[model samples]
Target chain A: MFKTTIFTLAIMAPLVSACGASYAPPTQRLADAQSAERSAAELGANSVPNAQLSMKLAQEQIAQAQKAMKDGDNLRADSLLIRAKADAELAIAQAREKGAKIEGEKAVDDSAAQKATNVGQGATK
Target chain B: MNTLRNLGLLCAFTTAAGLVGCAANIPPQDLVTARSNYERASKGPAQELDPADVHAAREQLDVAEAAFAKDGDTQATRDQAYVAARKAEFAEVRARTLQANQTKDRVVAGMHADERKAVALTSAELAQTKGQLATQGVVLQAQAATLATEKQRREEAEKRAAQAAADLAKFATVKQETRGMVITLSGSVLFASAKWDLLPAAQMKLNEVAAALTKEDPTSKMVVEGHTDSQGAASYNQDLSQHRAQVVRDYLVTRGIASDRITAQGFGPTRSIADNASPEGRANNRRVEIVVTPAATP
Candidate 1:
């Protein structure tokens, strides 16, 4: 009875974990209407998105894969492991980009008025 | 068939011999108690099962009891009953634990679903607030732009007023005072000696200057500064200078400029632009200087 049940369960489990994974670097860009409204108040759009949520999602997927293995679903577990690792790497890339965006925005906000004044005065020329 | 019969005969003879020998540790008289006290070593500390776990748990106890009293060797049968008892105990506990874990897992899963729902609702509300903020941001940006433009217009008007002043003067005398702007007018024209009263002609000229200031910016934020020559004691001159500047400001207020925007200050010979040694330079220093300060662009 144990052998029969184990074999049948293994066969059934393959269908659950068998997946066609698609990859996309998800980005949230503000629409023109939203940007216009934001510009009225902050004089700028929300340039930084929540990158940590993505990292957490990737980490969660990795945990789910580990759980599948412990639940005696190795074939499904193996497939999830690959996708989870890829997502984690994607999250790292997003983190780097987010940091760069923050630095870039600070640079823009700091020098905006001074640069505008200097250009008007013809000091550089 | 003959070999089977001989083997069976050997087993019977052995049992009969064992019945004649030692039989000390048979289970107690209570059938229900014996079953209830079955060894539960295999399942460890997990909960024991309900009566529903096995269909024949009680029936098996009765069967073992009957065998202990009739035909079978008491000691051998008792050992067999105890082994079965341990297995029943383990299975009962194991079944109960499995059922409890399933129930707990279901409750946890339900809570997770509820949390997910709450998160989705919060996300939608956040998106809406962000949208409103974005709209408000656009309006603020436009208002700020209008303010910037107004500041630029006022600055241009000031430049034009300065050019007009230069045009009005047949000989434009532009002197950079060390302290600030100091315009010199004769004492006879401004006030009578030993008296604080301003002359009618001098009041008219000062009004014209104030009108010119109004032309520079309708919002004429200015300071009326008065100075005195070192002809008297420090305290007297300070008081006299302050009185004169206040007089000038009051006259300007009557002319049209708002009182809130203008400030009257008196520097009584403390700050001298030219040497007090010469009469002409002292006269220049003694003059009432209207210092025009620029407002913030914001």
Candidate 2:
């Protein structure tokens, strides 16, 4: 029983060492998070309240992920980067929705104004 | 037996941990929330006001639904649902904002149009007013011209009347009669007794009279009448008066008076101005009378 326990412990130790050796920096996740944040900002996320808040959260998470990467905590950094990317994507969606809505409203208003001007000109004529 | 038992327990623990780590169950709550949010957005203002946002949201929701269906209870499914939910909420916010902006834009545009119309109306009104003023100016100019012509006519008439009065005072004893201005000259001063010859001094007086008559009205007609006393035979007196009147008319004609404008007549012992029984009265009765009629247009 003692030999079997020692053998099990030896097997687990090698597996744990192998897992620790597999640590890689979250470069791809960080890039994805930064790309998502840039897209959100381009979509005017910072102009809306809810979307701005989400963008801020994503920014903080990405900062945290950078810190974790600096600290050699690749797993923690990867997780934080994923979360940041998701938040940034959500922010982008929110911003795009708001922008589209504003554009639609502007179109309707422009049409109405044009009609009104045409009628007024006709009346004058 | 104890070592084997320990190994089995360890194996069971490892298996349980592995199962826990790989438990990719669908995030039912998140999926439901995402689906609800998407449905609400699709039916609400997002559908029309923000079609692009709505389309994005729908696409995210579909991805989430697919993820969940393909890998239920997985991190990928949860992530997809989270993103979908966020997109749905974003779509609703965007729709509301867009609608509000549309209304605001419409109001602003309407105001601008009204302002533009007002400006155009003002310009037109101003142009009309200017045109009216221009017409009034033309009318005023015409009236001014008419007034000027009337003033000139009045001035000309006044000048002519003053000149006629001056001529009457300087040269002849003028009297207004029904015929026109009558100038009386003593027959004794114009001719030698019963003779048809004018005295040299009488010629100067006649020249002055002729000048005054011509200046007064160049186109006037003159009648020369010879008067005589009642002392002689009517035939002899008539012959003498006619010859004397003809001499006076001929002398005026020589002094630039048109012969066509002078007519001579003799009245002997007729139309006397005074009683012929008195010498002084006879003297006044034997006078030459010149009557001048003014021209047709003064």
Question: How accurate locally, in lDDT, is each candidate?
Answer: 0.57, 0.81
Q: Please, what are the lDDT tens digits per residue for candidate 2 over residues B223-261?
A: 988889988799988988888888889888898888999
Per-residue lDDT of model 1, residues A23-121, tens digit only: 221111112222322232241212324334434544565566557656755544554444344334334434444444455455444455544554464
Each model's TM-score, in the order given?
0.32, 0.49
CAPRI rating of model 2: incorrect
Over the full model, what C-alpha lDDT does candidate 1 score relative to the true structure? 0.57
Q: How much is B8 displaced in model 1, in angstroms?
A: 40
Residue B169 lDDT (model 2)? 55
TM-score of B chain for each model?
A: 0.42, 0.49
True contacts kept of 1: 0.00
lDDT tens digits, residue span B1-298, model 1: 9999999999999998787654533444433344664434223333334444243344555566677767454533443354344335434544544555554555555545545655676677789989999999999999999999999998988887786566434222334454443344455568766456798877767766666666755453677777888877988888888888888888888888778878898888887878888988677667666765556446
Q: Report the number of the highest-lDDT candidate.
A: 2
Candidate 1 off by > 4 Å:
A1-125, B1-33, B38-53, B66-80, B99-143, B170-210, B215-298
